[model samples]
Target: MATSSFSSFILIFSLLSFCAIAIPEPRPASWSSKTFGPDGPWNAVEVVIGGVGQNRTAVFPGHAWHSWFTSTDYCFLTSSDHCNDAGGYPLRNSGSSRVSMEFLQPAQEWMAGVRVAGEDGFMYLDDMDLLFKGDNTDYITKTSLAIISDQMLALPNGTQYPALLGCLSLGSPEANQTFVEVPGPNLNGTMIPWPLAKRGATPSSSFGLHIGSGITVARMQGSLFWGGYDRNRVVGDVLALDGGFYEPILLKNIAITVVKGASPFAFPSTSKPGLLAQGNSSLSSSAGLPIVIDPCSPYLSLPRSTCDAIASHLPVTYCPNLGLYIWDMTSPKTTQILTSASALSFTLPGGTNTQTLTIHVPFRHLNLTLSKPLALAPTQYFPCYTSSGTRASVLGRAFLQDAFLSANWESSRVWLAQAPGPNIQPGSNPVGILPGDTAIQSGGNDWATSWDGFWTPLSEKQANGTEGIPAPAPVGAGNKEGEGLSAGAKAGISIGVAFFAAGLIGLGILLWRRGWIGPSTSGFARQESEIALEGRHSVEMETAMPNSSRGGGWGPVEVAGTSVRDPIPLGEVDGTSSSSSKKGLATSGRHVRSLHALA
Candidate 1:
């Protein structure tokens, strides 16, 4: 009985070990990782713009030309699509529309109609993600807002109106080769792509924004993600945006404080709220102002009164020539302020457990320049401006440098978190945002165990089925067979193939060293030359011929008997008298006929 019991224990131990080896480990669901820019954080993928079969252009992060404010109170593409002929006429004549006409009928069908509203011109539903690579891998087909080109129009008195283009036509006659058209079925104005629409009864679709250093600094890069965010990129706890305004994201009870004295003041000061309430009525009297976050603007534009309060404490002077206040970095008084001024922090409303959201901007980040073309020269400046008659304060790219913003349009909520600086490396693994009301960590065990003691490889559908979400179509796959393996499995197979290729290269080198392969041809061939007749008249060709004079040494030589003109040089001849030499040659009938026969 003791021997039988010991044998049963051994059998059970052996089975457990086999199960551990055969079962694949469960991993969190995630979208494929993409890189960030021409220069950006480590391990982050770089972003490029343009369409498939078109010239792809790298999107330079922190590039002033490409930045813009998030749309508020309007779907720019929708407005452009329904625009009248006055708005649509310009696109038909513009360079982008003419090229779209040239594409095959199938490609032309996908072209979103064009809109040209005076100076505000745009094309709708046209731009696409550069990484799509001819496949609808991200389910990003028939979406809006791909290429935006905003042109500034000068108005009366110096006021400028920005003409925003939802879809920019790359219509330059020279650059026609670079336009890439989106591939798929035609989408009507009302139809929304599955990816952009609300997902699984959720009120909002999730997206993450990581804005890197502005153009003032080098190696700047930014990241934008749809459906989820990189937790590793954020430093502090995620905070909720204020609950008013259906269009723009807003923050409440905002308070700003400058560090005083020798030691730097601790940020998010606990006593300042009460102190400001007692001392400064201008700041304390009102609730937080409606604000819009714009990545395109370099400076922070605040209410004129608020700017007056902040400027009173800092060492700043107004420049009449530039029509703006400049921070004199060279002044001794400014130097003293810089030493004590550690940072400026903005406090916002955070829901419940997380009481408040604060983003701290360092003094060094405030130092910037009025870049060329925007200014006459590169001028030292601070990133603060005053605005009058504005509905909301603008928190431009300057503020975003220190913050990570994520927006969930389907849920109608925005997440604000303090960002890791520009140099941090990205995490190897990233998780996708699950549907609303679904537990983030559940369903993995059930899917892993569904094989029921039979170890079958998990397909993408099976994994997504366990999570109660539909799997996106595999990129570039031609049929269902192509979808059998997951992206991770394909990546592993690719690595194996690379190793095999390296081994073959080593074998070729060994064979070459042992003289098993013969030498290759130099690619040149030899040809024989025939000798010229002794009595043949030789003509000297002029190295440089005059434009007006035709009868040079290299000019046509007329044979006496034949109408054909031979261009052979008989002797040294000048451009001036080649005609006389030709006449003499024509008189020698026998010699000319002999030359003609040889010609």
Candidate 2:
């Protein structure tokens, strides 16, 4: 009797299912945003690693390495313990705080980045204690470890970490290729990119960076973003790299120009040879030039031939023993080059059939300094170093100082744009770069929103500001908003509203059949598909990455883990900067006829 009654109810429900009705799709949820304090989704967020000065230590976090900060970004270990190597001078802070590090893993993993005074540095990763949570960002703020790199160490004659620490061996929660992945047994460690994604704060594993200009010129603090980019930091055309986000860029030309008379005098022209090509570039020999962008890299490591060419024009001398150019303080050429020079331009494929991209790094930006073990006293030097022949040449912090970079794992896309010059403060408005297929949306809100004026969408601005081609518009948009509805909009609404009533009636009937509402078939609660909550206490995720044939060449410092000789971390960056006047504006202009030329 019960089976016959159930069969009769199913037959009636199937007949009612033919009604025309609609169900709206649910909105995607994400973190909300703000103009100050906490950053919005995909906006700039500062990750403090080291503390500085004597008075402000209390305000910093627990893991902050309180050390003396320097303008020139010389990489150092903050721990107090010294290594076996006593040959070099250390770049660190006070005597109280030393390099606080412990190495538990047995394998000495060979890493890339940060060319050391000796060799590349390597360290081990501890796995058991860390989980990525939006509230507690240990994977970013302070390191969660049992023990790490206690063996091979250098830097800090006896001090602590200062300023910011950029790149590390921390692997992405998704793919290590996205963030700095240290390929272990199976991509074992977790880093910054993962937490943002796991928490739904970011649409995907992505980050944007703009290190800001030198203190001498801009005095701007660096900007960092998770899963999104600041729309204002970039100016001119946005170049989408042809290669993978993990690979090097193709350099079309590099020219240094000096203003002479009316036009600009330039060198390293196609025929003149300003910058040379690197043989060790990941690309083919004929492919223009390959340059890796590293925030931790303090100096601009280029081809030796390029350095030779640049040296001949300036007063700086290359001391092969030191692997750097020495600025002869007494030379008149030194003074002239520093003040009279105009710009050093690096031209790249503009991502268009017609236009090309050019980033003019101010000649004044190349000024750098060396102190202590590397030098007897503080000395100013040009920041160009000959590229080590092992891997691709590096376009370190020196270049990033004037360039904008954005990376995304979901889209596997990387973008490069010219950074704004000194004294120009652009507003902060971060937009998220959503997941695979890379359909971008308004990040701070769960629903997708289109970012206007993001790519300089205006016609006039696109022409003068962008330089040439712009990247594609952001993908995806949420509910539409407007003052008045158009014919199509009105029609869509009418259909939607009409279906709403019908949909409710259908829902009632379905509920009744399922013993959900006003029903008495069995009288039991039905299981819900999903639940909304106010958030939990903890969020955990797995870590690892696939092996890749590509990587950047870092350095010689070793953090004695396991001597298996495998690729490791990318180095850190900081440059000595001074922004006094270039000297003799009218004086130099009058001498242009006898001074120099553009080409």
Candidate 3:
């Protein structure tokens, strides 16, 4: 019994241990760390928690914690208090006064936990490099590696920082760029303690501390992600295909013009609102397109401030339908000015309006190869008319300046070589054909016109009887219909087959009766025929004579073919002889009647 009890206890303990190991407790919020360069007053600093701990409360120094863009991926950091305690580190040091650091003037500061890498330190530029030692090094490494392991942030540019070491490239956050120091000094001319500042013990709206002496603060600048994108980069984001035959490249700003003709119900301008007065059109770039704005437009789903910022050009947007579209040439900024000069009526729900805009922008960057050199000395953007009455626009010098175009007529292959320009059709060489060539049309329509006739279509086969020749099908004819003979022909053939079958049956019956065929051919007719003939004969003989006309009453006639002969009077046969001549005459008449009946 004791052994059993001991076994039960052991089993329970093992089960509990297994459960604990399998389901781990929630991780601490402060498990990750952040690092800065040896230089003081660095530009733009953010403590990114690139892990499962994003939603967990973050305790930071001298600032309240607030959430920014919250999703499964990430949450922005803001200053706010009265939030739940993060599992990692609780803000510490409840005190009235705190340390501070001056960005503009780094010297003459008094506070606790003061550690300076250099006398006058400040981080400049978008990229930075630093080294950490002991505990600081470990913390930096932990944070950097943690964020990178999330696989959310990409380092395309070849730059290295204290904790993070990697290259950042195009389309990266670093490419966006930013400049602003996250952590600043407090009121006291000294550095603020991490725990105290995080806990709101010595909280200040800005990066300041409660101190008797004043300190010069720094104003750093940097981009979010990295360096902010330029106009060219912004435009490239649009018209980008993930997997396409043509590769897109950066297109520099080109000159352009906007046509003007005012009417009601115009596009984009009437729908969009801007700072301009009523009836005034203002076109600006939003996203990658040009947007026209009218005054007093209704607020969209976006925030009012955001909309205002966009209208004022504080932020750029490309909404083509909103009267903002990119053109071949012309700066987006210039287009706005042009609208004002033209006095174009821009209002909500404007009338039908037409505008002609010319821009020298690169339509697209293509990756192409040419099999043969193309001659573009005289013709440019010329039309390649096909015999099918379709036209293909060829790439002119305007599209492919200093670009090579190659074509192989035999292989029907064409390619744009070297600096991989845009794909455009080549002009038809009307003069290239030999003079008086039969392939050329009489109306000087070029060889292409005669290559395949347009109005006059050629048949699939010639009017000659040839087995291999292709033939055109009748209208509405399908594969099944084509496979079989005509319906009428089939019906006639079926009827002929039925008649032939009937004739065969009749011949078989005739042969069977003559013993030319088997017994079963007559179908049991021989016995029936014999029986019928005998029955007919017996019926005729019975009805012919009556029983009264017996034994030589009148007269007996002999059978012509048989040997048996007899002659008897009719009166004897009837068994009644008359008395005298008169009686005998009457009897003779009776006998004649009797004989007639028997016959």
- Per-residue lDDT of 1-599 in model 3, one digit per residue for the tens? 99988755555554454344333111111111221111111111223222222233221111111011111212112121211222211112212221111111111010001111112111111111111111121011111110111111111121121111111111100101111122321111111111111222212111110000000110111111111111101100012111111111111112211122221112333222342222222112321111111000101112123223323421123332221212212333222222111111111111112212211211111111111011112111111111100010111222222122221111222222211111111211111111111121111222111111111122112111121222212231111101346679789978865755555555555556788666454431211000010111111112122211111121111000100011212222111111211111011111223211321
Lowest lDDT block of 10, candidate 3: 209-218
Candidate order (TM-score): 2, 1, 3
Error of 1 at 197 (Å): 9.4
Tell me the deviation in Å of residue 535 in model 3: 99
**Model with the higher lDDT, candidate 1 or 2:** 2
Leading candidate by TM-score: 2
lDDT of model 3 at position 134: 16
Better of 2 and 3 by lDDT: 2
Query: Each candidate's TM vs. the true structure?
Result: 0.47, 0.50, 0.14
**Per-residue alpha-carbon lDDT of model 2 for 445-520, expressed as tens digits?**
2100112211122233222233333442323221111223568988998886675645566666776889767635
**Could you give me the TM-score of model 3 versus the true structure?**
0.14
- lDDT measured at residue 31 in model 2 versus the true structure, 0 to 100: 15
Give the RMSD in angstroms, all C-alphas superposed, for model 3. Answer: 55.6
Looking at candidate 1, what is the lDDT of residue 529?
20
Cα lDDT for residue 481, model 1? Answer: 12
Instruction: Give the Cα error of residue 155 in candidate 1, in Å.
Output: 10
